[model samples]
Target: MMRKTLTSVWPLFFGLGIIGVCIGAQGSLLGIRAELEGFDIRVTGLLMSAYYVGFLLGSLRAPKILQRVGHIRAFAALTALASITILVHSLIIDPWTWGLMRLLTGFAVSAIYVVAESWLNQAANNRSRGQLLSIYMVTMLAGLSSGQFLLKLADPASFELFTLISVLISLAAIPILITATPMPSFEAARPVSIKALYHLAPTGLIGSFLINTCYAMVLGMGAVYASKLGMQVDEISLFMAVLVVGGMLLQWPLGKLSDRMDRRSVICAAAFAALLFALVSGQTGFAADNRHLLLALLFGGCCFPLLALYLALTNDELTSDQAVGASSTLLLVGGIGATLGPFMISLTMERWGAPGFFWCLAAMSALMAGHAFYRRLIDPLPAAGEPSSFQMQAPSPVGSGLMKSPPSEN
Candidate 1:
C-alpha cells in the first residue's frame, strides 16, 4: 500500500521541484543581469516589481482558469509558457520590455503553482499529507537555493547564462509529461473577501504584505547593493545564499514559538530585530564581509520568517473556509507589496546610494512592528480552544490520500 501510494504521488513532487528550479533561476538571474546592465538601482527595482504585478493578477485568476482547463493541461501549457518566457528574457535588454515579459512570466508561474498545489492536495491521504508537503517545501527551498549557485556557472556579462535558465525551465516539463498516472481534477473552494480577511486577522494580513515588500526589495537589488559596496559578483551570490540558508535554518525554531504565543508578539520582535540589522548593515556600508554572514543570518533566518509567521498568524484566526479565503487574500496582498518593494527601494537607493536599500528595509520592518503593536492593543486574545478558521494546512500534505481541503467561506 505504501509503495503504491508513493508511486502515485512522486510525479507531483518532481513536477513541483522543477517548477521551483525555474522560479529560482529567474530570481538569481534577475539579480545578476540587472547589475550587469548598468541599470540604475531604481530602474532595476521597477523592473523587478513588474513581475509581482503579473503574479498578483495571475494568482487571482489562476483558479478559475484551472477549473476550465483541468489540471494536467493547464500545467503543461503554463509550464511551456513559463519556459519560453524565461528564454525570451535572455534576448531582451530593455528594462521596460523585460518588465513586461516578467509580468507574463509571473502570471504563468502563478497558474503553475495553482495547478501543482491542487494536484498535491488531491493525491494526499491523511497519513501522507504531512510528508508530501514537507518534501514539497524542501524541494522549493533547495531548488531556489541551488538556482543561485547557477549564477556562478555562467558569466554574468553574456546572455548565455539566461539561455541556461531557459533550458532548465524547458526541461522541468519532462517529468510531468512522462508520468503515467491520471491527473487530479482541481478542487473547488469558496471565495474569500479581502475586507473580511482584514477584519479577522488584520496584523497577519498586513504583515504579510510588508514582509514581502522588504523581501522583494532585497532579492531584486541586493546584488547591486553588494557590488556598490565593493563586493565581487561571486561574493554577492554568497551573500544571498547565506541569507536564504539562514532563513531555512531558522524556520523550525521560530515557527514553534509562533505556534505557542501570540503571533503578533513574534511579528513585533522579528520586525524590530530586522530593523536593527538593516540599520547597522546600511550604516557600515558593507565594510564587514565577515559580518555579511551575520547580516544574512539575521535577515534571512530571523527576518525572513516574518512571512511564515504572518501566514501562521493569519491562519490562527480563520475557520477552514475562512482560512482558504484568507490565505488567498494574503497572497494577493503580499504580491502587491512585493511589486511595490523593488521600485521604492531602488528609488531610495538612487537618492542615497548604498544606504537606501537597507533604509528601505528598516522602514518597512518598523512599519510592521508598529502595525503589530497597534493590533496587539486593539485585538484581545481569543478564549482558550477557540476554533480558528484560518489555521489552513501549512502546505499541501504528503503521504495522505486527501487531507481535507479548507472549506471556502466565500
Candidate 2:
C-alpha cells in the first residue's frame, strides 16, 4: 500500500522538491547579494517582508485562480511567472526593484504550494495520508538543505546564481505540466473569524503567531547576520544547510514523542531548548567558531516543527468542517507575524549588531515557551485518544491542506 501510494504521488513530490530548492537558494542568495550591494538593514528587512505580504495576499487569492484555471495550468502559469521574476532580480540592483521581485516571487511560490499540496491531499486516503505527508516534509527539507550547498556553485555577487535559481524554478514546472495525472479539484475555503479561532484554541493560535514571527526573523535575517560576521558565502551555505538538516533529522523523533505525551509539554520543551540555543549562539564569544554551527543545528531541531504542534492542537479542537476555516485563520495570523518579523528584527540588529538577530529569536522563543506552560495550567489536555491524529505539517502558512473546503452534501 505504501509503495503504491508513493508511486502515485512521485511527480508531486518531485515537483515540490524542486520548488524547495529554488526557494531555499533564492532566499540566501538575495540576502547575501543585498548586503554586498550595500543596502541598509531596513531596506533588506522590507525586501524580505514584502515577500510575506505578497504571500498572504496570494494565499487568499490563489484558490480563486486555481478554481478558474485548474491545478496544472495554475501551476505552470505561476512557475513561469516565478522564473521570470528571479531573472528580473539579476537585471536590477535597486532595493525597491528587488523588493518588487520578492513580492511577485512570494505570490508565485505561495500559489505553487497551493496547487502542489491540494493535489497531494486529493491523492491520499485516510490510511496513507500520514505517511505521504511525512515523505513530503522530508523531501522538502532535503531539497532545501541541498539547495543551500548550491551556494558553493557560484558567487552571490554574480548573475550566474540568479540564473541558476531561475532554471530551478523553470524545472519545477516540467514534472507537473507533463504528467498524465489528472488535476485535483479545488474548493475555496471561507475565511474564519479570528475571534472564534482564539476561543477555539488560544494556545495554538498564539503559538502559531509567535513561532512564525521567529521563523521569519531567522530565515529572512540569518544570511545577513552571517555576512556581517565576515563569513564567506560557502560557510553561510553550510550554516543554513545544517539548520535545515537538524530540522529534518529531528522532526520524526520529536513528533513521535509528542504523540505519546502531552503535546503542549513537548512544545514548551522545544521552545525553551530553542531559546537556550539561540542565546548560546548569539552571546558566547567562543561560539564564533564551529560551535555556532552546532548551536544552529540544535536550534533548528527544536524550532522547525513548532507549526505542526500548533496545527495538531488546533485540529484537536475543531470539527472537520471547521478545520478548513481554522487553518486559514491561523495561517493569516502567522502571515501577519511573518510580515512584521523581519522589519522588527532588523531594527534590533541595527541597534545591537548581528547578535541582535539571535537575541530577538531567543526572546520570541521564550514567549512561546512561557505561554505554552501558562496555557497548560489553565486548559487541560484532551484525553489521549481524543486528540486528532498527528500529521506532519508543511512549514509555510500557505500549504496547510485544510485550506481546501470539503465537498458540499446534497
Candidate 3:
C-alpha cells in the first residue's frame, strides 16, 4: 500500500524537494552576503521580513491565480519567475533591491508550494493522506538540510553562487512539467475569522503566532548571527545543517508523545526545553566552538516541533467543516508573526551582539512556555474523540486548502 502511494506521489516530492534545496541555500546565502556587503542589521532584518510580507500576500492571492491558469501553468510561471528573481539578486547590490527580490522570490515559492501540495492532496485518500504528508515533510526538511552544504560550493562574495541557485530553481520546474500526473482542480479556502479561531482554541491560535515568529527569526537571521560570531562560511553552513537535521530527527517522537497526552503539556514542555537550550547557547562560551553546534541540534529538536503540536491542538477544537477556514486563519496568524519576527530579533542583535539571536529565541520560547502552562490551568482539554490525530505540517501554508475532516481511529 505504501509502495503504491509513494509511486503516485514521487513527482510531487521530487519537484518540492528541488525547490526546498533552492530555498535553503538562498536563505543562508542572502543573509551572509548582506552582512559582507555591510548592510546594517536592521536593514538586513527588513530584507528578511520582506519575504514573509510577499509570502502573506501570495498565500491570499495565489489561489486566484492558480484558479485562472491551472496548476501546471501556475507552477511553470512561478518557477520561471523564481529563477529570474534569484539572478536579479546577483545583478543588484543594494539592500532595497534585494528586499524587492526576496519579496518576489517569496511570492513565487509560496504559490509553487500551493500548487504542489494541492496536487499531492488530490492524489491521496484518507488512508494514505497522513502518511503522504509525513513523507512530504521529511523530504522538505532533508532537502533543506542538504542545500546548506551547497553553500560550500562557492563563496558568498561571488555571482557564481547566485547563478547556481537560479539553476536549481529552474531545474525544480522540470519534474512537474514533464510528469504524466494530471493537474488538480484548485479550490479557494474560506477565510476563518481570527476572533472565532481564538475563541475555539486560544492556545493553538497564540501558539501558532508566537512559534512561527521564533521560527522565522532563527531561519532568517541565523546565518547573520554565525557570521557575526566570526564563524567561517563552512562552519556556518554546518551550523544551519545540524539545526535542520535535528528538527527532522525529532518530529516523529515529539509528535507521538503529544498524541498520548494533553498536547498543551507537550507544547509547554517543548517550549521550556527550547528556552533552556537557547539560554545555554546564548550565555555560555559554546557559541565559539563545536559545542554551539550541539546546542543548535538540541535547540532545533525542541523548537521546530511546536508548530505541529499547536496545529494539532487547534484542529482539536474545530469541527470538520471548520478545518479549512481554521487552517487559513492559523496560517495568517503565523505569517503575521513571521513578518514581524525578523525585525524585532534583528533589532535585538543590533543592540546587543551575536548572542542576541539566541536571546530573542529564549524570550519567545519563555513566553510560549508561560502561556501553555496558564492555558492548561484555565482551559480544559477536548474529549478524546474531539481532537484530530497529530498531522505533520509543512513549513509553508500550502496544505491549508486541502485540509479535510479528521479521520476516525482504526
Please tell me which predicted candidate would have the highest lDDT against the true structure: 3
Global lDDT scores for all candidate models: 0.71, 0.83, 0.84
What lDDT tens digits, residue by residue, belong to model 2 across residues 179-277?
A: 776667778777679999898888889998998887777778778888988889999998888887887778778777877778889999999999999
Between prediction 1 and prediction 3, the one with superior lDDT is 3
Off by over 4 Å in 2: 285-289, 381-385, 402-410
Kindly provide the TM-score of model 1 when superposed on the true structure, using C-alpha atoms: 0.89
Ranked candidates, highest lDDT first: 3, 2, 1
Which residue runs does candidate 3 get wrong by more than 4 Å? 285-289, 402-410
Arrange candidates, best TM-score first. Answer: 3, 2, 1
Q: Between candidates 2 and 3, name the one with more favorable lDDT.
A: 3
Q: For each candidate, C-alpha RMSD in Å? A: 4.1, 2.3, 3.2
Count: clashes, candidate 3: 0
TM-score of each: 0.89, 0.96, 0.96
Model 2 gets an lDDT of: 0.83
| Model 2: residue 376 alpha-carbon error in angstroms | 1.1
Worst 10 residues of 2 by lDDT: 401-410
User: What tens-digit string does per-residue lDDT give for candidate 3 at 186-244?
Assistant: 77778789998888889999999998898789888889998998888899899988888
